[model samples]
Structures are given as structure tokens and as C-alpha cells.
Target chain A: MTGQVRTVDGRVAGRRGQETRQKLLDCLREMLSTSPYRDVKVIDVARMAGTSPATFYQYFPDVEGAVLEIAEEMAKDSDTLKELVAGKSWAGKSGPTTSEELVDGFLAFWRKNDAILRVVTLGAAEGDKRFFKIRMTVLNSVAKPLAEAVKELQAKGQADKSLDPNAVSGALVSLLASAAEHQKAFTSWGVKVKDLKPNLAPLVYLGVTGKKAPK
Target chain B: MTGQVRTVDGRVAGRRGQETRQKLLDCLREMLSTSPYRDVKVIDVARMAGTSPATFYQYFPDVEGAVLEIAEEMAKDSDTLKELVAGKSWAGKSGPTTSEELVDGFLAFWRKNDAILRVVTLGAAEGDKRFFKIRMTVLNSVAKPLAEAVKELQAKGQADKSLDPNAVSGALVSLLASAAEHQKAFTSWGVKVKDLKPNLAPLVYLGVTGKKAPK
Candidate 1:
């Protein structure tokens, strides 16, 4: 369980302290969305929040630490992604519907938190374990249940037994993440924005069902 | 036709100038691999190359500009990825072979240029048009040909005609790119490094051929 939110000095945060910490976090989020992560300094974040760098450090260790806090908040929100896949039926007409909803929900979540997710991705790529764990939390929110669904279907011989459920689910989730991350790339490919969900849903259904979606 | 390489000052570079410029780029590439892109400065690159910041600016405008140069060179090298899909047969046993080779070659290319590609991905995500264009040049090197292969298969009644070839091909390539970019994610999922190609090749084959890969 998450213990009480505390300051860098290990003091429990009161209501006022919490409010100020939240304010700094909001401003930091704004800066991350507008500028490259590399240019985001503690001083700039403090200036944006109308606070001194000393105050900023009173709450968090550094820019990466503050960013991790934001990422942790996003990962908590990512639990909402669970409903998109958990207990979803992948049978007959219902499979394609489940796929469509999952695609829409996933893409929307990504677009909402893209800036922070971008930094998380970069940090993970840079061999940062904290970022990697945070990213896995988000990805696993959907991937874990999705893999179970695949395993269930394969056991019933509804899906391809040859495919590894974890890899299939992981690849499908990665495909969704990639599509969400690079929606612009699809546009340049002449795949319209309106075409993304329609196009991606069937692929997800195919990956899950090992057959074309019900027409 | 290709144009001659020139310095930032609008002067054609002689052999020595080109060598110096090339050295700076090489050093920049090294710097990028070792450090975060945002922290990569002209001074550091010049120091690494045993040159001056003036010489660095003499050939490029800024860190991003120099990164673009390295990316462009890598894009040129991406031309080799075209052969992985161009005119490749996707019928029966050959389909899985093509898939394996494509996965292998794509993963190799991504690993070789992982550092700069990471920056390019971040820039494109940040809506930098120059980086987006450069990223497309590399993706299109593979995506375009793979799209054509899918179209051919769909035309011949081999693949699911209901699916959009461009979208399907784009998704598969994105999956590969994602897999390459985050190979660590798979490892953390208990997927071994050696397990990647075997697992991904079938998915690629399935996406293109719309059938279970022939064993």
C-alpha cells in the first residue's frame, strides 16, 4: 500500500504542503508537454510554478524524480485500460467490438498522456530501470489480461496454439502503443486518421482470434 | 542527382573539410550513444573530436542539425532494408523465410543505429517536422516495399482482401520497430533475446500471408 505522501526530508505532507506539491507537479506536466525532456530543468519547472528551486527540491529529488512521480500517477490511471480487455468476449460478433473498443480506449489514453509517455519511453530506452518498470506497469495493465484471454482461447482451440500467448499479446499491445505513438507516420502513408481504428481493430481481432473478424 | 556536400558558410568543402565534418559527425554519434540527446552540445562533440566549437558550427547549425545529418546517413543505409521485402515471395514455406529474414535484418539495423533512432523517435513525437520526415524516410524504406507485397498478396486472393494493405503493412512494420526499440521489454517479460525472431517471424508471416505460418 502507498504510505502517506512525504517530503524529501521524510516529513508527512499536510493539506497545504500537498497542495503546493500538486501545483508544482501540474506545472511540471505542462512544461513536459511543451518542451523536450532534455531542456526541462528544475529551475525552469520552479519558474513556471512561481516557486523557488529550493521549494521544488523540498518535495522531490530532481527532474527525473519529479518526472517519475508524474509517471506513477499516469500508471495509476492506466488501470482504467484494464476494463478495455478484462473479461471481454472474443467470440463471433463480440470479438471485433471488443477489439474496436480496446483500440479506441488505448489510443485515447496515449494521446492524453503522450508527453510523459514519450519521456518514459526515452528513459526506458536509455536503460533507466525506474522508467522501464513504470512503463511495464502501464503496458501490463492491458497486456496481462489480454494474454490470459489468448491463453484461454488457445486452450479451447479458438486461437492459434502455435503462438506464444505472452508474445502475441505483447506484440499486439506494442502495435497499439506504436500506432498511438506514431499516428503521424500512418498519415504520411496515406492511411487517414479515420482509417486508424477501423484498420487496427481487425488486426487486433485477427491476432486474438487467429482469424478474420466477423463481417 | 546528388549535390556536393558544403559547409554551413555556403562554401564547398574540400577533402580536409569533409574529413573534419565527418569526424565531428562520428564523434556526435558516439556522444549520442553515451549521453542523452538534450545534453549533447557542440562543445562536447568538438572536445571529443579534438576540434573546436567553431569547427562544429562551421559544418552544422546546432545539435539537432548535427543529429539530422547522422540520421540522414543512417537513412541512406536504411535503403538496404528495402531488399528484405522487395520482390520477396510470401507463398507457403517461403513466406516464413521472408518473415525471419525481414525480422532479423530490421532488428539488426535498429540495433546498429539504436541511439540516434531513439532521438529521431522523440523528435518526431515532439512534432518536429524535420525529424518526422527523416524517420519516415527510414520506415518507408521498409514499409513501402512491404505494403506492395501485401497488396500483391491481397490482389492474388492470398491475403484478406477486406483488410487494407497499407494499414496492415504499416502495423507490421510498426510492430517490428517497436519490438526492436524495446527488446528489453520482451526480455523482462521472460522472452529471451534468441526467442524474438522465432516469435516475431511468424507474426509477420501471418500478417502478410493471412495464414498460419507453414512449419
Candidate 2:
């Protein structure tokens, strides 16, 4: 478990202090959703949280630091994604279903945290080590177990043996992440929102099983 | 054809004016690769270009506007990506070669323009319509022809009929784009940089043809 929350000045946050800190974080998260990342400011966050800038500073050194905190929390929550693949059947009818659930679950998680994720992704692509690590953590939550599943399928002679299991899983996860991030792009390409999962799940099935999804 | 280049105030730029504008843009592009997008300033870009902020403003309204100019240029260049898939054969050994070349060409394009694409991607993700449009133009350059290829395969009874051609091509293009943008993520997952194309090419082949790549 994470140890006691502390202020920027290094004081351990008491119960009331933790509540205020959480409130500030919640407000910052809300502001990020509505405004461009570059325009978000501490004073606005402080005003929204019914606190002073000094209080905001006590909990976070800056906006980026606070954003990192939210990203870290989201990365931790991504652990649940493992269930979408781990110990799940990728055989026959069960295979396509697993792919569907994985796509649905992954897309839902992305939609829920998209605003924060936009910043995290931008930071990582900009070569920020901290954001890069947080992103890898999130992607690896599913990629690791998915790779194992691909390896199992290959061992059983059910999947392509020539492909690198890690690469296949990594590409699939990257595909899911990209599709989730830019769902609008698909819309403009004439693929409706409802059609996204149906299309994506089959590709996942194809990638993992090296066969078309069963009719 | 696109019309002559004009300044922010609607003046058609003469030869000397165009040279200055191009220099400013080149300097800004260099600055973007070195600095965070949020931290990039007009004064610095102008300073780097050996000009004043007034000269910078003559060509572009602001930093973001200049970025849009660069992104637009890149989007135009992306038209070359269409050749990567247009009229390409997707049968037998030719199919895997096509996939390899497409992946190679796409990744190389992305790596060369990664800095601008990162900002364009971030801006689009944040719901900016202009950036969204530019990003679409770039992706469509490849996705359109790629979708046509998938449709052709499906028509020939080579790919799955249950799948949507547009969706499959969109997803595959999304996968390549994501993988290209986040190659570092794969490296951390234990997939070598050199291994990315070999691993990705087969997935593309499998997705489009609905069969394993031929050895």
C-alpha cells in the first residue's frame, strides 16, 4: 500500500488534509477535461476547489506533478484489465467473445479517463520518462497476459508460430489503444460507433488465433 | 492547386518574405523537437530564426498557428503514403512483401515527422477540430487505399465477409500509427526496435488476408 500522503513541504497529511488534497485533485481532473492542458492554471484549480493557491501548492508542486499523480492512479487501476485476457478461453466461439469483451472493457476504460490520458500520452511521446513508464505500466497490464495466451496458442499449434508472441500482443494492445484514443477518426471514415467493437474484436481474434473469426 | 502563400494579414508573400517565413518555420520545427509544446514561445522561435517577434507574427498569428502550418505541410506530404498500398498485390508471397513495405514506409514517415505528429495527435485528442481534420487527412491518405485493398480481398473470397473493410483497414492503420508513435513502449516490453517491422508486417497480412503469412 502507498504510505501516508504528504504535502509538498514534506508534512504528513492528516485526515482533513487528505480530503482537501483529494478535492484539489478532483477539481484539477475536471478542469483538464474542459480546457486545453496548456491553459490549465493553479489559480483556477484553487478557485474551483474553494481553496487558496497556497493550499494547492502544499499538495502539489505544479500542474504537471498533479497530472502525474492522476496518471499514476489510473495506471494502478489498469490492473483490472488483466481479467479480460488472463485464463480466458481463446478457442472457437469463446475466442471472439473474449476479444469483444476485451475491446469493450478497454475502450470503456479509455473513454472514462481520456482527458488525463491525452496529457499522459502527449508527455510520453514527448519523451518524458515518468509518463513513458506510467504508459508502459498501463499497456503491460494487458499485453503481458495476452502475450502468454498467444504463446499458449502457438504451443498448441493453433496460432502462427513465426510471429513473436510479445510483438503480436503489443501490436494488438497498441491497436486497441489507438482505436480507443481516436474513435472519432473511425466515425469520419464511415464506421459508426456501434460498428467499432464488432470490427475490432474480429481483428483481435485474427491476430491471436491466425484465423478469421468463426461465423 | 493550392494558391500562393500569404501572410497572416492577407498579404501575398514575395520571394524574400517567403524565405523569412520558411526560416522561421524551420527554426520553430527545430525548437519543437527540443522543447515541450507548451513551453515553446514565439520570442524564442523568432530569436532562433534571427528575426524579431514582429516578423514571426507576420507569417503566423501565434505559435499554434505556425504549428498548424507545419502540420498542414506534413499532411500534404502524407499523400505519398497512398502508393504504399494502392494497386499493390495481396496474394501469396507478394502479400507479405506488400505488408512489409507498407509497414516500413509508414513507420519511416512517422519517425521523420514524429514531432509535428505528436502535437497534431494531442491537439486532435483534445477535441480541436482543425488538428482533428489534419490528422484525418494524414491517416486517410493510407487508410483509404488500404481499405480498398481489404475490400478487394473480401470480394475475391480471400478475407472474411463478416468484417467491415473500412473498419479493418482503419484498425490496422491505427495499429501501425500507434506502434510507430510508441516504439519505445514495445522496446520496454522486450520487443527490439528491429523486430517491430517483422512482427507488425505479419499482423497486417493476417488482418487483411485472414490467413497466416506464407513462409
Each candidate structure's TM-score, on Cα atoms with residue i matched to residue i, is 0.95, 0.97
Model 1, C-alpha of A149: deviation from truth (Å): 1.2
Off by over 4 Å in 2: none
Clash pairs, candidate 1, are none
**lDDT tens digits, residue span A1-215, model 2:** 87989998899999999999999999999999999998899999999999999999999999999999999999999999999999999998899899999999999999999999899999999999999999988898999999999999999999888889999999999999999999999999999999999999988988999887777
lDDT of each: 0.91, 0.94
**Alpha-carbon shift of residue A72 in model 1 (angstroms):** 0.6
Model 1 chain B lDDT-worst window of ten: B206-215
lDDT of 1 by residue, B1-215 (tens): 77998888899999999999999999999999998776788898999999999999999988888889889888899999999999889987788899999999999999999999999999999899988998999999999999999999888998889878889889999999999999999887777878888888888887888777766
Q: Name the top lDDT candidate.
A: 2
Indicate the worst ten consecutive residues by lDDT in candidate 2 chain B.
Answer: B206-215
- Candidate 1 lDDT tens digits, A1-215: 88999999999999998988999999999999998787888998888888899999999988889999999999999999999999899988888999999999999999999999999999998888999999999999999999999999999989888778888888899999999999999998999988999989988888888886767
